[model samples]
Target chain A: MCELLGMSANTPTDLCFSFTGLTQRGGNTGPHKDGWGVAFYEGKGVRLFHDPQPSCSSPIAELVQSYPIKSKTAICHIRQANVGEICLANTHPFVRERWGRYWVFAHNGQIANFSRQPGPCEPVGDTDSENIFCDLMNRIHHTLPRDAMPEQLAAVLVELAEEYAAQGVFNCLLSNGQWLFTYCSTKLASITRRAPFGPAQLKDADVTVDFEAETTPNDVVSIIATEPLTSDEAWDVYQPGEWKLWECGEVIASGKRQR
Target chain B: MCELLGMSANTPTDLCFSFTGLTQRGGNTGPHKDGWGVAFYEGKGVRLFHDPQPSCSSPIAELVQSYPIKSKTAICHIRQANVGEICLANTHPFVRERWGRYWVFAHNGQIANFSRQPGPCEPVGDTDSENIFCDLMNRIHHTLPRDAMPEQLAAVLVELAEEYAAQGVFNCLLSNGQWLFTYCSTKLASITRRAPFGPAQLKDADVTVDFEAETTPNDVVSIIATEPLTSDEAWDVYQPGEWKLWECGEVIASGKRQR
Candidate 1:
């Protein structure tokens, strides 16, 4: 299985610390290393960095860890290649433009026997994850109105997630720069850091960062991952069929469905 | 105005040498200091690197110059920002997937008062270049069949390029990994290097490269840019209304029209 990471912040914030922890799992602490990619949402624009090499040794990953590219919402994935070959096209997270906005998506788990009809949003690579992402985009393009709000969009997303989860695991993180929508079919966890931010130690690497020193009191930052990245932080684990819509580092709407 | 760079090769080749020269014009040698982006096509997959910062001093540009990411086709742009603001969203070359293939595009000239009807393929940023790109995609999506060959696509592209050129400047480089199609409304130049390659000196920077030492005899590499990147090489300048379709570093079809 692949590992997923996401972040939502009230202010533009960097994912250097969390990303460093996740990169360690990509090839060092864990074996989830076939390729890795990250998408950082800067306004309506997204900066994507994809490397087919293992994250642990990728020069691109090193640059990502060292550079402080601030973003309001970001999605990242470290792949272990259960379905697709190791190539730049098959690397997650995948991005597609919809409704004059960029939608970035990253999937962690697999969907057995997944198939979909070709649509406007076609997959350039032969990955089940990308196939489903294109499927979701096609559904949204055909069903949803152009000006659909987050709540209305989430309703459709939740419905699709439930159906996808029934087929197999469907844990995913999606964002359109404005909001982040995460769904959990098997494993997912998140932590929100606000005013009383404290120093946190990484579970995967010998790295620690004092959130208090880097963040302001009013700054709110939330991080979501397939597993909790920090050792000390109290992460909220998601139930099997849970979905949440996040904006400005807060969960605006959330629900759990029994699969 | 912006500086455009594109490459088409019979085999996988790195743009490090050419890119280094173009980047110098991003700020140090020219006025195009707004933003810069590059897309390297590895099969159907295109690895993109975008930065709103000026390429001459951008850290990401440094990495691109140093890393040898081999690709058969590539498109790059360094913007001066006339129709759009200097932001990540407006950076080029822009990318979208069509017919299960990634289409990468970069524009050098401006399109004044460019507008388009919204379609499935939309622009995430508000730029005249991106607006025209979406319009082109929409036209191809609606008019052309999914299985249309390169020639059929080029027929449609040449028509649209002529229409857009009538309004304002429309020098562009577009590729779908398989073939590269370039249209020149005002300024464009190209050079193809093969077996008997000699040493070349950069026009923009103090950099010299011995292509004879680096390339194989069978390798045919073609480079397209707004102007000749090297001082020593003789570049073929495009006429005002000229278009060419390139594959395997060779111009398979080319034509010129009087506007």
Candidate 2:
């Protein structure tokens, strides 16, 4: 299986610790050693780093590990290459511009028989994940106005996610520089750190970080991943068919449809 | 004025030495110190690195100089910020997706009163360069088919460049992973190296590279820039309003529209 890691924070925060833990799965602690990519949203612009090489040994991944690029929102993925060939074009997270904003997305689960031609948006690589993303973008372009409210956007996204989940596993994390949207078809987990931040130890690696030393009291930082990155932290697991809309590290809306 | 650096090669070639010279101009040597960006096309995939910080001191730029990310086509720019603020969104080279291909572009000149709103293609960055690119993409979408021939596309691009040049300086480089299109409204130079490759010394920095050590006999590598990068090599200068289409390190089509 692939792995995903996302962050939504009120203040600009670095993802070095969480990313280090997640990268371990890309050839070390986990079996997802195909390729890895990450996107950091800095205002309306985004910085993306993608490597077709395994994250465990990639020089670019090492640069990302050491470089402290702070961002309010981030999305990352380590691929196991189930649907697409192992190539640079197929690596995620994929980014496309829409409504004058760069929209970033990463997926962990796969859908079966998911063949759809692109409309206004197109998939450069032959990935079912990218195909699904293009389909979603096309639907959004046709179904909603450019000035749609965030809630309205989330509602449409939920409907799309539900339909994809009905097809197969459809865990995903999406962001458009303003907010984050997470959907769990099978498995996903999240944790928020605020006020009394504490030390946390990675379950896959031998690293420990004291969040209090890196953040202030009023900082609200939320992290979502395929699994709890830290064994000590109390991660809130998302049930199947669960979706959440997060803004400024706070969950503004959430729902779960019984399947 | 900003500087432009581009490469279209028959083989996957690294731009470390040339890029090192360009980085010096980003702050140390020349005055294009506001921002810098580069795009490397690998197959249908693109590896893009943009930094609002000056390239002379950017850690990401340092990695690019030493990491050896080879590609067949490359476009790079060091911005001096003529019409936009020094932010990530305003940095070049800007990227957009059209007809399922990622098109990378960079401009060394500026445009005046370029306020054409985006159509299906939007500009995430608020730069005159990006706005002009968005306008060009909109026109291309409206003017051509997805399967338009390369020459047909170049013809349309030339008309657009001529129109933009009438507004202001319009020297630029563009690529869609297949061929490189270079438009010279004011200044541009190019050199093609093949068998019996010799040493070349950079004019902006104290660096010399022996092409024979880094390449094979059949290798044909062409480089295009706003000015001659190497003081020792004889670079063919382009006339004002001259445009060239390069594929596999060779010029396929070229014309100069006398202003």
Candidate 3:
């Protein structure tokens, strides 16, 4: 299992403050130090970076920390090796083209005996995570209408996810430049920040940030993770077999636990 | 990248309606058949299953489809391969003990050079995903106060995630029996369902369901995915850098994307 990090905000914001603490887990504070990656949504486009190196020491990671790319959404991960050999191709936050738009994904859990004949979408690496992304694209290309509604597509995704989860562990985060979708079988947690911004402290490194100084009274920000990243903020824990759909930094819908 | 499936409802709902369609992608329709897994959250606990086989043909997966394990939340996944060898140890929906509760997680992306000396927490398998998960636990154990608020913890998580994202791909889902946190760096999409119910069809498989027939007027559900899963529903895409905190089937807070 790997660490997952996500953010959604009502206003364009920088994740640098929060990200600073997360990177420490890549090696300094945690174990997920194989390689790391992150993607930032800017308007209708995305800025992505990946490296097959420990985030704690990766110069690229350092660069990201110093750069304050602003957007409304972001996803990041630090890896620890489960499937493919360590390499850049096997990095998380895998990106692809779909419906003329770019799609990105990252996972923290492993699937067993997962093997599929490559479809038109091919994996750049041997990781099961990348292969799964390709296969999902292939399915979307083959099944969805050119102009499908988000709800309709979500239903289809639910169907697909159910099938996959039945075969093994299936907690994940997915996005397509419009909204963020999350599904958890186990070990998922989240925190939402709105209006009354406050102070926060990092658990990975000796760092702190006063969100009140960085955000506005109308700003709404949310953060998701495999575990709580701070020592002072409140984080909600996702029940096993729970999921939610998010748009514009708010959950428009949700589901009950699947037993 | 991996395939994700999620179901939420006012009442405990069985995912059979959607699982039927998603299973096709495990092998017959898509390529995420490396292994499959599913978890149904029953109240505070979770019922999980993992198979090192293609969901399309896995007997376990078939059993899951047939079993109407109903709950408020459910998560599923189909793997393609990225981290460790395709085996049970590598299967996802990884579970851990935290704050006197069980936590679960699954992933769809890969990390590059995530190598860290395992502390008290160690990966059961060789997959980067597992390693990351264990690392997260180790960090949480040593960092967060056992009685910290969920929101405070989330702030810390955001910081850590930003750090990991700097290193490489980091898209993921995490839960701890109360809330779901989602982070998107590249590709993630989500849909929320509430009040008015409608009919839905799967894109990969010839399957359809009428929410009006299966859900109540007060039912609110959400589904998250890497891509839109249906051909008709409107799904919101996540920005390049965004994350959301979800609770009770709704988005409570979100984070902004920073490049």
Candidate 4:
């Protein structure tokens, strides 16, 4: 299994504090340390940093932690390598362009006996995770219109998540720089920080941050992870086969399907 | 105009020496201070770094120069905006997947009044260079099979280059990691180093490298740029209507057309 981290915000926000906590699980506090990657959505552009090294020791990950890259949406993952070899080619998260927009996807957990037809967008790596991403793209490209609304796309995405969850674990995070989408088949959690936010301490790392000092009252920042990253804050845990569409740090649409 | 830097090597090599010289042109030594990007291929995966800030002073570029990310092939560019705004989306060395292989492209010249029909692949940025790349991919997708050979792709590539060159300038370098294809519309130079390699001095930056000490006798390395990066090395200058197919640092096929 692997760890996933995601953030959606109303304004440009940096994930230094949250990312610092998550990096601990990559090698320090957990066993999910094989490779790590993060993608920060900067308007229509994405600043992606991928390291095929354990995040705790990766120099690139350290740079990312030390550097404050502000973005509206961000997705990160730390892998443990269950289905693929430990190499740069199989590292997450994977990115491809669809309808002139870059689509980024990262998966956690494994799909046993997973197989699919070759799609218009093919997987660069041999991982079942990348294969699922390509399959999803193939379906979306055929089903959605060139200018499909995010809400309209959410229905198909929910259906796809349910179908994949039926086959196996399908927890994943996806984004197109405009909106963020998440599906949880096994494990997922989230916490939204807004006005009246208090101090929160990381569960894995000995670090704490006060949201009151860091944000304005109107600022909305929501973080999603494989598990609750901070101990003090109450995280909203997702039920099995739950999916959500997020924009501007708020869930625009959400549902849970019994698989 | 922009400055391009590429490498094709028989063995995995680092582009720190050539990249350092190119970085100087991003702001310090040349007029191309708009943006810079580089793509390093590790097996089937590509590590891409893009910064809209000038490379000479960009912190990300500094890390890239300081850290040695070795690769068998690399494509880099420093852009002086002509048809697009100074932003990450418009940065050169753009990447996309075609038939499971990531295709990287960078252009040094402008295309005046260039337009093309939309295709399977699309550009996230509004640059003539990206449009040309998209058009090239559309044509290739329609005309070639998924497993087209590099040599077979070369013929169509040359034709596309000529068609784009007819509009204006179209100096560009493209690679699918397996092979490199270069088209010179105005200015491009290449230097291939093997045994008996001596010291080389950068033309723009105050730096020198002894290739004899750095490379093995059997190592074959080729560096291509908008201009000869080194003042002491003998570079093969490409004519206005010339194209070459390179693999393992050797030119397998070459041709020219009267314009």
Candidate 5:
């Protein structure tokens, strides 16, 4: 399995602290040293970087650790190959164009005997995750309007996620330069930050930060991950078979279990 | 890159609705079809599944979509190869034993020059993402105390994540069967849901659901993603160089930006 990291904030923020800690996991702390990638959202645009190398020792990873790229939204991944070969084309945090906007996705699971016919959106590699993404695009193109409401689109997405969960593991993160949609089937967790910031420590590295000093009282930042990256802060656990829609660092809608 | 889908709720919920919508993206609407995986957290334990096939056509994905897996915290992913070969070892939602519990992760993005050196926790696959995960484990073992607080861990994790972000993209999701920590360097967004549930639809599929009918007044659910999956709903965006801690479907603490 892989690792996932994401952030949504009310203010433009730099991910320097969290990035540093997560980098250690790339090669220093954790066991998923396959590959790594990350994407940042900046005012309706996205900036992405990917490498077929471990983040612990990668020069690029080092550079990211030192640089402070500011944005409103971000997504990152570290891979553990389960389906595709170790190559640049098979890295996580895949990006695509949809409705004239950039969409990004990443995964940390596998589907059993999953296959799909070619579609308008094609995978650059042979990973099943990419194939699934393309298939979703095809379906989207064939279904809702390009400018549908978030609620409408979310309903359909929930339906599709439920269908996939029925088949096998379907843990995933997806974005379109706007909202972050998260769904879990097994082991996913998240944390959100608002007023009354506090201190935090990294479980993977020897470092700490006092969010109270860096954030405004009105700021709201939310994060979702497969696991907790820090050790001191309190994090909320997502219930199984649940999904939430996040907008501007707040959840607007969600799905419930059918009894 | 990989795709992530998560669901959170105030009450125990089934992911049948959103899973159906997200599964289509695995092979039909999106490009992260390399493989798929999911974990359903039932209380403290988790039910997980993985497969190295496109989710659209994978029997496993189909089963997940059809099955009504219920839990409070869940994580799912679909991969698009960028570092490791197409094999089961390269699949995501990687799990590990930590603090006498299971930790899970899913990632999106890549790091350059990550495979030069092997860390204490080596990558099971060739993907740089896996190597990074191993490195993180190694760092945790070396840096943090066995019974460190979540906030302390978050601080160190933020420092490490910042370092990695300087090198390249470092957005990610991580969990320790308790809380989820997420960091964003780029392209991360999210939404939180509580009372006033309404109808929602999918941008990629022709499906819709009325949350008001399916949820109670006390329901609170949150989601984080690489992008906004829906078209109608308003999704919050994450600022670059930011991280958040989540617990019980709510935001807790946040990081400061140094960029």
Candidate 6:
């Protein structure tokens, strides 16, 4: 299995603190040492940094930790080779442009022997994760209108997620800058911080960050990850077959897929 | 207007020398400093780095210069922001996937009052350059087969380039990792360095590099840019209606678009 990290915020925010903790798991604290990628959405643009290197030792990862690229929505992944070879093409957080918007997707767990009919949206990489993302894009393009409502999009996403989850693990994070949609098949967790934010210590790294000193009272930031990143915060663990649609750091809608 | 830089090589090569010189034009030595972006092709994958800040002082540019990300093909751009605002969305070197391959494009000139019928491919940013690219993509999708030959693609590209160039300036560089197609509407230059290489000095910066020390005898590296980057190299200037198809650091085909 790999690791996934996602963020949705009311205001532009940096993922340095949470990202630093996750990098530790990429090689130092865990065995997911293949590659990692992150996408930070600024308005309608997404700045992507991908490195086919171990996060703990990659210079690009180091820059990501030191530089504060603020964004309203973001998705990141650290991969452990399970279904694809260790290469830049097989890196996570695959991106595609659809409906005049950039869509970013990242997967955590594997879906064994997954295959689908080819369509307009094709996978550039040889990974089951990318294949599934392309399949999802094809379905969205064919099933929904260009200006479909967010709820309509979410419904389609949940239906596909449930189908894929039935084959194997299918936890994923997807976004189109306006909203973040996350689905859990086996493991997922999330935490939201607002006005009462306090200092939190990382579970993987010996680092502490005071959210009170960094964030404004009006700031609302939600973080979703495959595992809890902080020890002090009460992260809400998602039940299998559960999914949520996030916008402006809060869940607007959620549902449990009937197994 | 904007500045474009591209490289095609028989072997994987780094563009640190040329990139360092061109970055000096991004608000240091010249006035094209709205934003900058680069796409480096690794196998079928592409590593894209975009910064809305001036490249001369941007930390991301600093990282690119310091780190040698080798690739066989690469495309870069530095924008001056005439047709679009100074934002990440308006940054150049836009990318899209077509026929399961990433197509990277960067424009150095503008196409004023450009409008085309809606198609499957759409422009995410509000730039005339991106609009032209989307139109080109739509044309390719509808006009040619998925497995079209390089010459067929080039013929179609030249026809479109002539049409757009007649409307306004339309210098551009496009690549799909297999071949690089460059069209020069006004200003463009190129240089190919192979065996018997010597020292070269940057025109914008006080930096010198000895090609003999870095490259093997069998290496064939070609660079295409809006202007000659090095002071000592004899660059071949392209005519207003000229285009070339480059692969493995050599021009496999060349032609002039008749007005």
lDDT of each: 0.92, 0.91, 0.73, 0.90, 0.73, 0.93
Error of 5 at B102 (Å): 38
Please state the error at residue B166 of candidate 6 in Å: 1.1
Error of 2 at A51 (Å): 0.5
Give the TM-score between model 1's chain B and the true chain B: 0.98
Off by over 4 Å in 6: none
Candidate 3 per-residue lDDT over residues A102-207, each given as its tens digit: 4678877777877654444666567777767667767877778957777877776666666666667777778876787777766778889886778889888888
lDDT of 3 by residue, B1-259 (tens): 6777665445677878677777788888888888877777665545566667789997657767775777666777778888767765577766654553445676667777787544444555567776676677667767788676768777866666665566676666677656666767677778887768889888887777788987778777777776777878999898866877666667777886666
lDDT minimum window of 10 residues, candidate 1 chain A: A112-121
Model 2, range A55-96, lDDT digits (tens) per residue? 988898888988999999999999999987998899999988
**Per-residue lDDT of candidate 4, residues B1-259 (tens digit):** 9999999999998999999999999889998899999999999999989988999998888889878898888999999999989988899898999888999999988888678777888999989999889999888889888788777788889998898988999899999989989999999999999999899999988899998888899999999999999998889999889898888889988899964
Pairs that clash in candidate 4: none
Model 1, C-alpha of B15: deviation from truth (Å): 0.4
Q: Fnat of the models, one by one?
A: 0.78, 0.59, 0.00, 0.62, 0.00, 0.56
lDDT (Cα, 0-100) at B160 in candidate 2: 93
Off by over 4 Å in 2: none
**Predicted model with the maximum lDDT:** 6
Q: Which should have the higher lDDT, number 5 or number 6?
A: 6
List TM-score (chain A only) for every prediction. 0.98, 0.98, 0.95, 0.98, 0.95, 0.99
Q: How much lDDT does candidate 4 score?
A: 0.90
- Model 4 TM: 0.97
| Residue range A1-259, candidate 4, lDDT tens digits | 9999999999999999989999989889988788899999887888889888889988888889888899999999999999989888899999999988899999998898788766788988889999999989989899889788987899888888777888899999999989899999999999999998789999988998998998899999999999999988889999888888999999999998853
Give per-model TM-scores: 0.98, 0.98, 0.50, 0.97, 0.50, 0.99
Per-residue accuracy of model 1 over A1-259 as CA lDDT, tens digit each: 9999999999999999999999998889989889999999998999999998999999999999999999999999999998878998999999898888989999978888798866778899989999999999999888899798888999999999898888898999998899999999999999999998899999999899999999999999999999999999899999999899999999999999953
Q: What is the lDDT of residue A28 in candidate 3?
A: 87
